[model samples]
Target: METVSVAIASIGRETLLDTLRSLAAVTRPAGVDLKVLVADDSKSGAATKLVTAHPIKSLDVTCLAVASGNISTARNALLNAADGGWLIFVDDDEWVEPDWLVKLFDCQKEFNADVVIGPVKPVYPDNTPDWLRRANPLYTDWGHRGKRLYTGRGGNTLVRVDFVRALKLRFDEAYGRTGGEDTIFFAQAAERGARIFATDDAIAREHVPQERLSMNFILSRAVRAGQSYGQMRLARHPDPLWHMVFALGALAKCGVAGSLALSFRLFDKARSFRMRQKLSLNMGKLRAVFGRPLAELYKKPD
Candidate 1:
């Protein structure tokens, strides 16, 4: 029987309970020994307490008290604890479908892929702003189904344990607090000849909270994404000339985007917002290229 471990790294969010419940309700695949692992990053051990109080009888669940504000630390804890041939990662704010595991396995088998990535759909609240709702910037594009990808996110992914062990892949501690650890990890895996493929059937739904609905949050996230991409590019190719070339390209893009945003501000609000987001992203890339410190977006208050 193939052993499979589903892992989650959390900061004690109330939505984690719902995520656990969804996992308990998934249809287990035949001949698969499945287990669920949760790494509690909350210093207070809130997730550990919650799991102890309300156990899922249908699933074999284990919670580890990591107590680290760093997401990479929590994920590394999961990686160390997992005793499975395959590992699946899902976010605390997201829930999977009944056939999520089966679909991921099917894709892996079909493509002979080392890493299989699934799509994440955002569930917006009714009270969300109309413009934000219409724009839907939270939705991720993983390209078409069965297409090969150079990198993938950790939110909804199935990884072959043998491939990971072979490559000695681990999330970078430098990006632990600032996000993009997954981007760097997957990019490294792909660079080392890991085949990454995407599947359309295995879907995870992420719940968007009220705190993330603001324009400020959206633009900030865009900047963070750009920073991650810039950092990853530099890490892959450490030539000083490459850095200068990328920085110049980002500067030109930023100028063009800023001008377009100013020109469309009065007439096309949505287009203007998108242009502004693009400008912020390029500005973040510039910051990364110049070795500026990144904002710790995931750090918990002391």
Candidate 2:
């Protein structure tokens, strides 16, 4: 029988139980042996302890102690531990629909895809600000169903294990702290002719904590995203001329966004916020081009 491993790299957040609970409730495909692997990156083995304390009776869940504060390292641990024909990745804070796994499998088979990505809907708290809710910057639109994508994210994604192993692909440890390892990994997979497809049916809902609702978090995340894009571009093209051209393009875009933000500052708050976000993203790209170090957003607290 074919094996499918649902992999999660977590730091023992309280919501992890909810994630496991949701997985336990999912409909397993016939003839597929489903397994859940959690790579715990905590020094105290918090996730392992939690799982031991609250075991889900229906699922065969195993928690691996990675003890690495780096998200990439944790994810790599999951990849190393997954012994299966296919692997599914989900965030520790996200809960999936009952048919999420089935839908992912169907999409992969339908498109003959090496990788399948699904959307992550945000669940905002009741106390969330109206403007922040209106903007909804956290929602990820992975294009229409069956649309081919050049790159994919780790969260709510399905991967053919053989393809990844054949390519000897592993999440880069260099991006462990600053995040975006998935972006780099998926971009490399695409470059190597991996077909990635999007599916809307495999839905996962991520709870947006109160801390993430601030403009500070939003702008910082945008910058990090831009930095990831810049890093990917540079890695793909090592030529100095290409780097220079890319930096110039980013600068031009940044200037345009900044100006638009200023123009809309008084009349359109939402548009201004969006333009500012764009400006910050381009600035991050420029920073990456210039080899400036970014803040380690994923660094574990001491």
Candidate 3:
């Protein structure tokens, strides 16, 4: 009978309702209690109305209206109100597996992990490009696989209330606009020596709108990666020379392999295609090295 408080900061009122419905659908194990807290950061009072309209049968949900658009601020507001032993965060636009919370709690207890990062797979209702699907693993960092020790999206993470409160960790408002607040928060935790564990059992499905499938959205998303890469490197290593060396070395390796792949078609088509794709990705990483500040991308309209 462990209690888990799920805190969600919602901006879009329509999406909030959908999230609430999803939470209501999750079936918890006996003796375990689930509490859902929604910090509404919408200008209009639509979120309040939507929460009241919905009849959630499974979990106890509280929707509080707050006049702010910053995700970190809204999340902090929820944290202040939550009373459960563990705090779970989810995006308003995403829904979780029925056993998501149960799996998370189990892993948290087993690993004694300060933070648990779960998988977030994009749920596309319609047709989606193969390349986009293939890029999922590349974009998401999890389980100590990448340079970023903690890489799960904010939507699929569970943190111990005491640890978070002790460290006074809050999502960085700087990344609030580009939606990298989760990244900054995890980085802070990692820096503070928090033990983060990645779990696939606690799964969530993020609904990707059709609009985000376009090339413009894909390319624009690149800016966030670049910004995160730059910030992460700067935070860890202050040496500018090493950063340049690392960037140049990565570009050179990709360039050599890319040129060879184009010159010789001896390898299988699938293998060759993958090499070409790698070349393109390496080029993108290089571009990110010189891209403008992270704040600049926040200026562009989504």
The clash count of every prediction, one per candidate, is 0, 0, 0
Between candidates 1 and 2, the one scoring higher on TM-score is 2
lDDT winner: 2
User: What C-alpha lDDT values do all the predictions have?
Assistant: 0.88, 0.90, 0.69
Models ranked on TM-score: 2, 1, 3
Which of candidates 2 and 3 is the stronger one according to TM-score? 2
* CA-RMSD of model 3: 4.1
> In candidate 1, what are the lDDT values of residues 131-212, reduced to their tens digit?
7666677887786679999888889899988889887899988889988999899999999999999998898899998888
Better of 1 and 3 by TM-score: 1
For model 1, the run of ten residues with the poorest summed lDDT = 293-302
Report the Cα lDDT for candidate 3. 0.69
Candidate 1 segments exceeding 4 Å error: none
| Per-residue accuracy of model 2 over 204-236 as CA lDDT, tens digit each | 999889899788998999999899889888988
Which runs of model 2 end up more than 4 angstroms from their true locations? none
lDDT of 3 by residue, 20-112 (tens): 777777777678688988887877755666777776776698887775767767888887887877788988777888788778777777777
